[model samples]
Target: VMFFLFSLAFVQGVGSYLIQAGEDGSVTDDERDALLLWFGSVSTCMLTCFRVVTGGDDWGAYYDMLQPTGTINIIIFIFFVMFSEIALLNIVTGVFVENAMKLSQPELATLAFEQRKRDLADAASLRELFHQIDLDQSGKITAREWADIVETNEKLRYRLTVMGLDIK
Candidate 1:
C-alpha cells in the first residue's frame, strides 16, 4: 500500500508537471483549478490526502479539472481513490481489530502482571548477588571485590570511583 501510494505520487507529480510546467508558481483562473486538484490529490502528506477524501475541503474544482486529462487518467484516478483510500483502509482497520480480539482482556492483563512479577524477581536476585559480592559485609561493593568476582571493565572501575568507592 505504501509503495503504491509513493509510485502514484510520482505519477501524479509527472501529470501535474505536464499540465502546469510553463506556468507561474500560482495560477489565477482555469489553471488554478487544475493546480488545486493536483495539490489536493498528489500531496505527499497523508493528512492532506485524508483532507481531500473526507470532504474536509472543497474537491469539486479538482475533480472538474480531471476532465482534460482524458478518460483513462480519470478512470485510473477514481480507482486510485477507491482502492487506496477506501478499500485498503478498511482492510487495515479490520486486521487491527482482528488481532486485538485474538487475546481476551483477562489474558492480556495476566500476561502484563506475570511480566512485572518476573522483572521484580530478577531485580531482587540482582540485589542479593550484589550483597554477596560485598565480601567485607560493608554497605558498598569495593573495587577489590569487583576485581575478584568479575573481569575488569574500565568503565565499571571509573563508575565505582565516581560513586566514592576507593579502589584500594
Candidate 2:
C-alpha cells in the first residue's frame, strides 16, 4: 500500500512537472495533456500506477509520454518496479514461514510427549533393576552388590553400558 502511494506520488510529480513546463512553453500542450490523461488526478494516477505495477498493458505509451520528464521518470519507474517486487516477495515468504511454524506446533508437542513417555518407561525399568540388585531390600544397591551383579549378569552389564554407565 505504501509502495502504491509512493508510486502515485511519483506519477503526480511527473504530471505536475510536465504541466508546469507546458505553461512555461518548454513542453507542448498536447504532450502535457497526454501525460495528464493518465496522471492528472489522484484517482487516475493511483489506478495507473497500480496497473503498471501489476503488469497491465499500455505501459509503453505511458513510458513514452514520461520521456519528457528526462531520466528522473525512468529512474522512478525502475525504482518502483524493483521495490514493489521485493516487498511482494518478502510478504509471500513471511506468510509461508508463519504457516509452516503453525503447522509444526502439533508435531512438536507430539514429539515431546513421546520422549517423556520413553523417559518414564526407562525410569520404571531402572527402578526394577535397582530393586533386583539390592538383595538386602535396603532400597539401594551397594557398590559391592553392583560389582557382583555386573560381573555375573552379562545382560545387566550390557544394559548399563547401553545406558551410558561406566559399569567397568
* Top candidate by TM-score: 2
The lowest-lDDT stretch of 10 consecutive residues in candidate 2 is 1-10
Where's the lowest-lDDT run of ten residues in candidate 1?
Answer: 40-49
lDDT of 2 by residue, 89-141 (tens): 89999999999999877777799999899888878888999999999998888
**What overall lDDT, based on C-alpha atoms, would model 1 receive against the true structure?**
0.60
Q: lDDT per prediction?
A: 0.60, 0.78
TM-score each candidate.
0.38, 0.64
Which pairs of residues collide in model 2?
none
Error of 2 at 141 (Å): 6.7
